[model samples]
Target: MLTLYHNDMSVCSQKVRLCLAEKALAHEAKHLNLRAGDQQKPEYLTLNPKGVVPTLVDDDVVVTESVVINEYLDDAYPKHPLKPVDPAERAKMRWWTKQIDDSIFPATGTVSMSVAFHHQYTPEVLDELTRQRGPGYRARFALLQKGTDNPNFSDAIKRLYKMINDMNVALERGPWLTGEMFTLADIAYAPYITRLDHLKFLGFLDKNPRTAAWYERMRSRETYRAALAAQFNPKYLPLMEEKGREAWPRVKALVGLA
Candidate 1:
């Protein structure tokens, strides 16, 4: 039996869940409460060493990293393939997914924290949250505390803008990120786009109509409903929506939309 250790609303976890849903695979779920620091506990650290969510176990075989896990799933279950059959298109898919790990994912976290999630903490809670992190995460904690004033915020906005602009250009060629196939590339980006939607930071999409349309097509998929929408955390929504909307003017200005 396949077992997945994941958090309900984590983007990485959502990516894995989308892959499983796309492939129609059956698996057991172990939910982690990230704010509660469940992922940092010794047991989970043993499984993922990095103390992150969406760790997949196929029988005794363990897999970490969302992109790697998705590729592993496609390779392990060939019935409903998520990767393109063409080599060039497959390479394109990898390129999109690679950018996520290299920059987009980190930017999402920065933007999300700067615009919304930082508001979720009180002074005491923030202290506890910061104390929970290891040395490497101190910079991120600083971003969370400083919000959009962080020096990195503008760069994060630029990265996300580049993502949307690039998506619009690529999508003009075909319906999905990697041309005709709704491959792992599409699955990989779904959550990040949804993050912009949730945070109301979609002003970047205003000029990128094709990327907007592509996002709508993605949202229309059953896998999106099953994997992402169904997993929405109620507690986080109000804060994300409220703070996200309030931050839009600044975010829009940062993206040069203003």
Candidate 2:
């Protein structure tokens, strides 16, 4: 039996869930409470040394990293292929996922924390949250406290805008990110874009109509509702919406949309 260790609101976890839903795979779910530091427990660390969510176990095999896990799912279960059959297109698909891991993922965290999530934590709670994070704790705590004023905030906005612009360019070729097929590339990016939507950063999509339209199509997918929309944390949603609206003007200014 396949078992998945994940969190309801984690983007990485959402990516894996999307792939599973698309493939119609049935698996046991182990949900983690990240705020309570469930991921940092010694037992969980044994499974994923990095102490992150969405770790997949297939019988005796274990997989970490959302990108790798999704690829493994596609390769192991061939019935519903989430990758393009063409080599070149497959390469294009990898390029998109790579960008997410390399930059976009971190950018999403920065944007999310700086804009909305930061407000949800107090200094004591923040300390507990980052207790097991070691070296990364200082930076995270700073971003949480400073919000949009953090030095990383501007760069985060710029990176996400570039992603939107790039997506628009890619969609001109066909319906999805890599032309024709709704591959892993689209599934990978679904949560990040959904984050922007939750954060009320809709203006980012305003200039990129193609990207906007693509996102609309993405939201309409059954997997999107099952894996992402339906799993939103009720506690986080109200906070994100409130702070996101307050941050919108500043975000617009940072991106020169003002």
lDDT tens digits, residues 25-65, model 1?
99999999887778889989999998898899999899999
lDDT string for model 2 (224-249, tens) is 89988988999999998899999899
What's the TM-score of each model vs. the native? 0.95, 0.96
lDDT of 1 at 254: 88
Instruction: Report the number of the highest-lDDT candidate.
Output: 2
lDDT of 2: 0.92
Lowest-sum lDDT 10-residue window in model 1: 129-138
* CA lDDT scores, all candidates in order: 0.89, 0.92
Best by TM-score: 2
Which residue runs does candidate 1 get wrong by more than 4 Å? 122-140
